[model samples]
Target: MQQIKIKQYGNAQEAFAFEEQEKPVPIDSQLLIQVEGFGLNYADVMARNGLYKDAPKIPFVPGYEVVGKVIQCGKGTPPDFIGERVVAFTRFGGYAEQAVGDFRAARIIGDRISGGEACALATQYCTAYYMTDYISNLHEGETALIHACAGGVGTALSQLCRRKGVTVIGLCGSEEKVAFLEAMGVDFIINYKKNNYKKLIENRLGKRKIDYIFNTVAGNSFKEDMKLLNYGGKIYCFGGAARSGKKDHILNDLAFLLKTGFVSPLFMMMKSHGVIGVNMLRIADNHTAVIGKCLGELHQLWLQGEIKPVVGATFQASQIGEAHQLLESGKSMGKIYVYW
Candidate 1:
């Protein structure tokens, strides 16, 4: 097997290496997949930074989701599974020429969707779908405020919300992303760089505050964005890209603790709002069956053309470093890919 493994804990430019290793063989009830393509995620970047909770030790392969064909089957494995195409979320060891996973964890990809598209949706869209439908409880015609509105989960939520007739107000980091969100049918876009997002929310939406807020970036913006939630609305906290950089201030630490603790949900109570925190990895860990169901629904939505995954770009296996660089630079809007 050829895999991209992290050799050190530091920046992407310094850590990852491409090397050859023995391919994995299936265990009891496990299926070995011949890699086609895999999606790059922020969790992969966090793992490289040594920030991801419970990340495997240094010198480990990091990839969450992949789409591939089953090449070999283990003893007692179902006979129908051989030669089937599937998508799955592996805790690690997915960025390689071959990997192994369980049958229940794998969702069969139907013939209507392409392999590349299925790979893109396997993790990103599944996360968004579960959060939007199960956690946020988003209703038709409800308004949604999406942070990181041009990234992988954001783009998926944009299309899904559009399909469900939910108006989306996209908040992104740049003007180019503003244009990108516009093309994706975003009802309004706020450039968090040059403008005031709080005022943009008030000015554009009037008194009907945001019905649901999907926040991937947390920090001062997380605190500020909470004010936009309407009565009985829910805010789903999924990621914390806002505090990505190291900080040293005494008050900053206190503030972050306060915000993550009581302040957020306290405000929710004051206004009859709801605050929900989601760690998809944790959800996948504890509620495996639920996560599998969500993946199945997302695949069906893709087959029906109700949602489309945004693939920023694809690279060959040797281009692993370049793929990580693109993710670190934040130049790409959606999931980056590495193919064998």
Candidate 2:
């Protein structure tokens, strides 16, 4: 098997080292996955920087999702799953030509879904769907604020939100991404680079407050969104990209924390707006069943033509560094991946 290891944390080009290794054998309840590809997420970049506490030690494979076929099964694994292509929510070790994962973390996919498309269903779409379809209770004619709206999870949430007839205010950092959101038919698309998005949100909704807010970029993003949430409204934060960028990004996060401290628990209770944080790694580690269930639900949505996974670009496994750099640049408009 060929694997990419995070040799050390620094620049993306210098962070990962590719090497040939013995093909891993699955242990009890694990499946040997012949990976066709693995999804590259912003989280992968943060892990490379030693910023994500959940990440493994240095010199580790830092992928969370792989799209591939189960070529072998270990003890306690179901017998019928030996020959299916699936999307796997691996806790780690996904950046390889072949890898081992617990059977519970993978779900079967139809033959029609491409590897890149299947990759999105496992981590990105599941997080988006779980938040909007299951938790937010978003309704028809409601208003949603989707930050980083051209992102992987953001695109999935936009699709689901549109399907439910919710009006979406999409925020992106680039003109290109704003155009991408415009093509998705967001009610309003604002380029955060040129416009004051907090003020944009205020100007767009003079009186009506946001019914749901999806934030992955934290810091002032969450603070500002909190002020605009409607009574009984919900806010879901998954990542803090504001705190995870390259070059002095950690400094930026510390600055924000120093200035704002934390959102007052008392204020949250008094305002009657619910705030929730999601860490998919925790879900993958403890609630593996939920991981499988989310993938199954997303597969159904794909079958019904209700959702489509967007792959902005695909890279070869050899180009892992470039893939990470692209994700770090925040220039890609949708999910990015590297395949064998």
Candidate 3:
């Protein structure tokens, strides 16, 4: 089997090395898959930069999702699952021609879906579904704000919100993203790079306030979102893209944390505001069943045409460095993946 390994922590070109290794066998409740491709996420960039705390040590594989066919099934897994074409969430080790993952984290898909589309469902769409449908009770006529609203999970979140009849305020860093959101029928689009998003949102809402906020940039935006939140509104923090790119710098990390500031539960209780943080990796660790459920629901949604996963770009296996560079640049509009 051939796989891409993180040889060191630094830039994408210097960090990865290709190597041959023995094909891994599935253990209890696991499935061995012949991977077609794997998707890239912002966390992969963080991992390459040695910034993600949960990432495996050096020389480890660093992918989270893959679209593949199950070639073998392990003990406690259903035998019928063999030969199924599925999209699966891998803890790691997905950047290879073959991989193994827990059967609970895999869901069957049809032949019509492309590898990029299937890869989108495994991690990005599942994360969106888990946050919108499983955890929150979103209602019709409500308003929600999505930060980084042109990316994979952001696109999924916008579509899910639209299905619920909620108005979406999509925030992005570029005009191209604003146009993309417009085509997707986002209720409002803000280019934070050119305009002050806080002011724009306030001017548009007038007396009303945001009902829910899906915030991924968590530095100063945390305090800003709190101010714009309506009574009883909740803010979901998922990523910290606002953090400086100085890896392993204690002062820089502290600066980012300080900018996020402090939150008092007492104040939130009095104001009826709520703050919730989401780390999908943590959820996968503690609640494995939830991953399966979310994957199943997202698959159904895609089949019904209720949601669409955009494939920003697809790269060859040899172009792994280019894929990482695009993801790190944050200029890619949707899901980016590399085919084996």
> Which numbered prediction scores highest in lDDT against the true structure?
3
Residue 276 Cα positional deviation in candidate 3, in Å, after optimal superposition: 0.8
| Global Cα lDDT for candidate 3 | 0.90
Candidates ranked by TM-score, best first? Answer: 3, 2, 1
**By descending lDDT, how would the candidates be arranged?**
3, 2, 1
Q: What is the C-alpha lDDT of each candidate?
A: 0.79, 0.85, 0.90
**In angstroms, how far off is 46's CA in candidate 1?**
1.3
Each candidate's number of clashing pairs is: 0, 0, 0
lDDT of 2: 0.85
Give the range where candidate 2 is weakest over 10 consecutive residues by summed lDDT: 244-253
Q: Which candidate leads the pack in TM-score? A: 3
Cα RMSD for candidates in order:
2.4, 1.7, 1.0
**TM-score quality measure for candidate 2:** 0.95
